[model samples]
Target: MNSLYHGSELCEVDADGNVAVPAFLEDAFAPETSPEIVVAKHQADDCLIGYGRAHLSTLAERAERRRVAEEERGEEARSHYRRMRGTFGLSERIKRDGRGLRIPPAMRHLGRIDDLALFVGAGDSFEIWNPQLALESDDEHFRALAEFRLRMRGTKTAGVH
Candidate 1:
């Protein structure tokens, strides 16, 4: 099972732009043979996004499936095919230098990354953000989260009394 990346960790982007992958989430990058990760721009927000090897594979598979389906459909499906294909791809491996992993330049600009960054663990993936932006986003995220929790308060789980 994959562990989710959550919570905030204070991390510094080194002089070479490398940052350490939090030990807690390292397990998600298992199957050590495949050390490469996929970093993309967050679709909904300004953040450097990280996806595990397995997750990236799954995404690629899905996109291929869409392409096949679209080919059988019509030109209308071309746009959908393009959208899916454009979304995800493999990223550079996290480099080691006795310091940390080096973030790629493309990801840096996409996430608006700076010297100070926040690594946020999301299920199956992680997000990197500028410290200030992360803080501001968290406020809005949590506010909406509270409302969502309130809406779910009465929901019952099979294991819960």
Candidate 2:
């Protein structure tokens, strides 16, 4: 079976730009191989999506099927190239070290991430969001979750005991 990701965790990002992969999501990584994750921009949102290295093959296969279908319809190659560029060209594969994955600068900019990253799992993949920005998300579920996280973070930071 494929690695499935679910649940959410808020992780800290260091000054050097490393965000620890939430322990809950560890199952996404293969035990035998070095930990590697692919980070890409969410197609319809201002957030980043992450998945195990193995998922890349799934993406390629899907893209190939789309290409063939488009070709059968006599569609121009532009559509395929556009899809490839968006899905492959803009993505980056980063390896996790002892501390965590060093988020690439380009991805950070694309994701608008800073000191805190909210990781929300979405079955096949997970999303990394800048909590503050996520509060304005068009997705009601995401917006509500982000608000709850921010409130929880505030409570913890200001806890008396």
Candidate 3:
């Protein structure tokens, strides 16, 4: 149900490994018949994250601004850049059509995605996963969210005089 970046879709990959785009999502895409998509394997998990080229551009701009700001604070942003380069280097630009998308063989192998695929919404992008891995990741994601909230609260409390 997370529509921010992903839609709730359980699509089956046909023999050709093509996944059909859900009508709701397909209708929401830009007018361009084929948009560039960047598919990456999650560094910490067994899933793939897809980033529309448009989204990736915007993200890069935002990240650059943040990196400059971090630089002023004498904080190293190189690690973040390294992670991004690693992911983007492994990414392939695939044409997205109304039918859905064709997961390149390399990306599929990188994520261990075989037949059944699940698309889950991410804030700025969406993730693709095999059903079982998706389910396991959901549990992990939920648990991480809780711990993250607690960590934030602790940081805020400690900052207060």
Candidate 4:
């Protein structure tokens, strides 16, 4: 029987980046708990984005929209579109070899993934991040948000929109 997977799970990846999928998440990719997963680079940091066949189809649709949006745009927009395409174009599809989820070499290198891995759930999707990188990236985000909030508060007092 299959079930839905939710919540965040911190997991470890071997030197080869193959991670043992927790029982909770195992069913998330059910019928074949070990289907081939599509891996792409995370936009915010050196993290890998992974999803099963079902979710990847949805992502492909969104990517198509972004690709089409840049057709009549300038160089910068075109570059951004190209990057988006390349990220997905270069993505790797890894399958579970019965032992664990095999994180492909290309994705592992791109995301700087090593022994320590953090699997974070994002609703229907999930992110694979190197623990150290995730910590540093999260701290930077917090700092940036704090500074932006402070600036906004000051602007409010000055009647700035």
Question: Which candidate gets the maximum lDDT versus the true structure?
Answer: 2
Q: Rank the candidates by TM-score, best first.
A: 2, 3, 4, 1
Q: What would the TM-scores of all predictions be?
A: 0.66, 0.87, 0.70, 0.69
Question: How many clashing pairs in candidate 1?
Answer: 3
What lDDT tens digits, residue by residue, belong to model 4 across residues 1-161?
A: 32334654556678777789755556576665547777788776678877775666566677777666766554346666666665567688887666478888888898888875666655666677765566555577633433343354342212213
* Model 1 TM: 0.66
**Positional deviation of residue 70's Cα in model 2 after best superposition, in angstroms:** 2.5
TM-score of 3: 0.70
- Cα lDDT tens digits, model 3, 33-88, are 24767788876778788766666667577667877888898988886687667566
> How accurate locally, in lDDT, is each candidate?
0.62, 0.82, 0.66, 0.64
Q: Is 1 or 2 the stronger prediction by TM-score? A: 2
User: Which regions of candidate 2 deviate over 4 angstroms?
Assistant: 155-161
Whichever of 1 and 3 has more TM-score, that candidate is: 3
Q: Please estimate how well model 4 matches the true structure, expressed as its whole-model Cα lDDT.
A: 0.64
Whole-structure CA lDDT of model 1 = 0.62
Q: How many backbone clashes does candidate 4 have?
A: 0
Clashing pairs in 2: none
Best by TM-score: 2
Ten contiguous residues minimizing lDDT sum, candidate 4: 152-161
